[model samples]
Target chain A: MSAFWIATIGTSVIAFVLKYSGHSVPERWLSHPKIQRINALIPIALLSALVAVQSFSEKSQLMIDQRLVGLSVAMIALFLKAPFPLVVLSAAVSSAAVYHWL
Target chain B: MAFGAAAVANGFSVLQACLLSLLTFSGASQFAVVGVIGAGGSSISAIATASLLGTRNALYGVIMAPRLNVRGFKRVVAAQVTIDESTGVALGQEQRGIDAVKKGFWYTGIGVFVFWNLFTLAGALGAQAMGDIRAFGLDSAVPAAFLGLVWPRLTGKFERILAVSCALFAIAMTPILPAGLPIIATAFIAIVIGMKR
Candidate 1:
């Protein structure tokens, strides 16, 4: 199978397993303060890393271009507490303009 | 819906994106899968990052299982839909009593599932029709979406700093490591801080 298929199916199965495990496992096992604290931070770390990777890097190389403007606009929109859709829309619009015009 | 478009923009087939929504159903993990693979990361990297992002669902399941109290086929179905929205709604209805909780869980869970899948299909089809997503700046939309997802979670100053630091750390690691590994490496920072406190 292709890498995409493998990742898709494999990740899905694992995600289901993680969900099911929570249902079946004893509450105390997962309720530990340390565990919960770590779990909460995991997404924060992964997502921030994703933002960096997506905005700054292009494949194996780091390239700065229109995406940076898009991300900056996103940050400003986020700071202004614009709705999620608006944030994405503003970023896309600004980035596209930069890509085409500059 | 954005996921559908983003997935296609990231090089996934419409069927693949739909399957992700149907099966995985977790937004962050699904996006991570597409993003990692699109960036030429290995399947292992994609799965690892996605699975790590999905750990919260298990926590949500733990909170919901007792409140739900189902059996056999129903239990399996309940597990599938045990997401943030369902659990949050179920908990929010706590003052109303058990019936409200159950109703909240089922209604919200199934509702999100149906709409989320439908929108995924729509977004995928729309993005597919767009042809050359880069021209439309959808490439930046992917990261912007990630930022949106994480934005609400940064509720405190420390969390905000940690997130920014992690972003920089990943960027610093980018030149040295492969595509997805930098993201994985940031988990250690969380672990260390988590251990310290």
Candidate 2:
């Protein structure tokens, strides 16, 4: 068995706990408007932190490449409500093409 | 799921396929980790990258927690569903003022989880029969996933920063940093920045 499986499955149980444990608590404890607003913001912050990293960071030192161009186009496509597969597929095609030619 | 199939086709085992889905449970991370490990990268690197990919779930959980209000056995089920799509659906339903959004979370969670896990096996097996997964653009899958996630959250400049800052930083830093770590680093930085503000 590859190590990835060992890690993934084991983590799945742990991740499951982390994800679900929050809900079992009493609603009054969590339902406060302030808590609600904060609960709402937490994901936004976490997601922002996440996407920021994925879009730009590569193993190398701050290199912006064809992927960025593809990303911008993809974002635009998303803004246009182009649908899931299309946005990604178009970005991949354009990035690959851009890399091949430019 | 598709990634798992690809892994098996490319020489992974059934256990490997399932573990990747159950544990790593992320296509881009799984593929990258497997590719790196297959190519002789260190275990540390593979695990680190996989964990980084999984961090997005932290976002899903934080967002879904309120709506789910789930408890006990159902909480167990709901947690399994706390990925990008299910979370989005639940949040969207709430925005539309749908009642029982918590139920929607459960439904989407179970539905996507079952299909996604099954597809992991499919992808693993498919990879065995097919030569490669290029037709799927698995690498390109991450940003699309992010877009689906980030689009619904964008409401202001604050959110724009919250959403785009880490990605932009990661892009700026990816060329210099190690693979997968930059994203994690950006999240940490954002958290630190957010906490301070």
Best by DockQ: 1
Candidate 2 lDDT by residue in tens digits, A1-102 = 456555455445545554554444444654455444444444454445444444443334344566666677778888898876577667666765666676
Best by lDDT: 1
Clashes (backbone N, CA, C under 3 Å), per candidate, total: 0, 32
RMSD of 1: 1.3
- Tell me, by TM-score, which candidate is best: 1
Which docking category, incorrect, acceptable, medium or high, applies to candidate 1?
high
Q: Which stretches in model 2 have alpha-carbon errors above 4 Å?
A: A1-3, A26-58, A61-66, A96-102, B1-75, B82-103, B124-137, B175-177
Go through the candidates in order and give each one's DockQ. Answer: 0.82, 0.32
Q: Which lDDT tens digits does candidate 1 get at residues B1-197?
A: 77999999988999999999999998899999999998879999999999999999999988888888887788878888888789889999999999999999999999999999999999899999998787788889889999999999999999999999999999999989988999899988898899888
What are the per-residue Cα lDDT tens digits for candidate 1 across A45-98?
Answer: 999999999999888788999999999999999999999889988988899899
lDDT of 2 by residue, B164-183 (tens): 66556655655566555544
- Sequence-dependent TM-score of model 2: 0.66
